[model samples]
Target chain A: MKSFLSLLIAFVAINTELFAAEAGMPQLDPTYWASQAFWLILVFTILYISISKFYLPKIKDNLDNRENKIKEDLENANKFKEESEAKLKEYDLILENAKKEVLKIHFESKSTLDKDIQSKKESMEKEIEKEILKAQKEISELKKNSISSIQIISGSIVSNIIENISGDKLNESSIKATVEDVSKKNMNKFL
Target chain B: MQQFTVQRIGPEINIVGVDLSFTNASLFMVISAAVIMLFLFLGSKEKKVIPNKLQLIAEMSYTFVAKMISDTAGSKARPYFPFIFSLFMFVLFCNMVGMLPYSFTVTSHIIVTLIMALFIFIAVTIIGFIKHGFKYLSIFVPSGVPAVLLPLITIIEIISYLSRPVSLSVRLFANMMAGHTMLKVFGGFVVSLGILGGWLPLSFSVALTGLEILVAFLQAYVFAILTCIYLNDALNLHH
Candidate 1:
């Protein structure tokens, strides 16, 4: 506090002295040079110290802070970018593996289905072939039965006509023999 | 003419036959220094990432001086950046303040510029001697000179080497004083002449004022750049 007052007093005194100095051409006047030099040295020294001490450091700090922040931000961005790229690669890898799995499943299912269809077709064909053979055998049997019955009926009719015309019954054995002979002779033509 | 005067503002003190009265020149020098201090201090107080107007100006000035030092004196002269920056700002402020009507032009005086130049000259010479020792004398002896003409070249080199401070100070002081005086003379003519006749001198004064402002900035730049060059010569001893 005491120093402050003294400084104030000194400031006023210096200013008063400056106001009292004679006005003239500064080049011709050598008297004021000393005062000017003294004040300049004092003021300049203070200014230089203040600037170096108080001012430049702040500016340097600001600049350094800005540069450091930018660098840190860039580093962070790069780190995140790398992380995201790695994640994307992992995602792509997983998708590729899933697609391969799906393809394998599809092919496995398709082959299984093709095998089932082939086995079913072979079984159905076998059943149809058996039914066709049975039907053919039955038709041949029916034809044979019908033909034998017709032969029997024709023999009976002939025997009855012979009895009516002669008024005497012919012997069964002879008739039978006659019938067989006749049938034998005309077999090729009739059949 | 009135702007060049240095009036004493307080009681005169005579110490060992030297007049040490605080004068208007002293006051303005202090003002210039104070203004610089305030500007820098206020500008850098916040230090925002996206700088405000004041901060931008502070940053620009900082980079500007740093660039100037590096350009003129190379990276080795980085240590003297504060001194060179201070000199530039001080001179610039003084010249600009002088451009204000009725304000004193500190740079217009030979004494102030001379003192600054002499300091630079002495500092550079001392640095040269300290760094290179007696080998520093080799600067005066040019390379590839014929044996017969060596002495003559050395003498001329010495004279030119000694004149650095004089030329440096005079260049600034003369430019500021002459430019201000011309502006004042033209302004006087404008006032003395009637309205119809005054337009010519007034227009010239306006143009001269604009030119003087440019010169003020240029002189400050010249002063700082020359100091850097001298510092470069001292540190590097470039022949």
Candidate 2:
């Protein structure tokens, strides 16, 4: 440090002596060094204080705030998007269930209608069979009565014809018996 | 010579044999400081998410210096950010202000730059000693050197280390002073040559002016980055 100070003094002395005649380069003049250093220190100190204390912190805060705001917005957007996606999924599920419900109802109604139609058809067929049976019974009875009446008519006619031709009358029971025998032998051929 | 003159602004102020009078140099320093403060004040006034042009410039400058420090000195240099930032901006503004007609260039003066460089050198040296104690002296010695050549290499390293402040200060001062002198010389040529022959020197002057502006910014950048490097060396002692 002592050597450095001596060197600086020597350098300053040499410069002053050399440039004394021409006033020298103003930068090398030793007279202004003190004030320059002083003001430099003063101005620099103020600058440092103002910058660190006021400017940088404010700028940093702004940047931090902007970053935080952007982050929050992104998170919110993501959350909303997720919610919407979930809602969409829920909507789809609801639609699918509604569709399934519709199909089930349609199938159930169709099955019920088919069952009702089948039962009605069966009851109608049974009623028609019963009516047919009853009709068949009545027809058989009529047939029997008609056959007996025919037998009686034929016997009476036979008796009338005999009486007219031979002047002799047959008894009723014998005539009926003769008619029944004739009818029984020729029924299949005549019918 | 008049460009570098340090004329006294107010009355002479001598406190205990020291001439501490404010000068034009002091005024310009204040102006530089005020301009920086105003710019920052304007930039930070609104604090908008979407920055205006002024704010963008301010923020970009801050980020630029921050990135420079981080890139050169790493995160450990974060605490000294304001000092380096002020130094850079002060030098940069001084150089830029000097570019204007009739404005004084502060960094062009060897005294101003030398003082700053010395301060950085002293501070960095002290920090190294504080952090690493006697081990800080090891920076002057190269590891894995041949025993015979180690002394020579150590001497060379010490010389280089001692020369850091001189080199740093001279580089900035010389660049500013030389560039401005060249500009002035060309300007003189343009004026002396009249309209017919003036065009050449005038054009050269124009180009030189542009170069000087770039140099102005570059010198400030070099100044700050070198400080960071020095800080890096101090904080992280390397052989």
TM-score of chain B of each: 0.97, 0.98
What are the per-residue Cα lDDT tens digits for candidate 1 across A1-191? 58655654564465445435644555877878888888877887888888787888788788889889989999999999999999999999999999999999999999999999999999999999999999988987876675566556666776788888987777766777677677667755755
Poorly placed runs, candidate 2 (over 4 Å): A1-23, A114-191
- Give one digit per residue, the lDDT tens place, for model 2 in B14-110: 9999999989999999999999999999988997888999988988998899999999989999999988998999999999999999999988999
Specify the highest-TM-score model's number: 2
CAPRI-wise, candidate 1 is acceptable
What DockQ would candidate 2 receive versus the native complex? 0.31
Model 2 scores a C-alpha lDDT of: 0.89
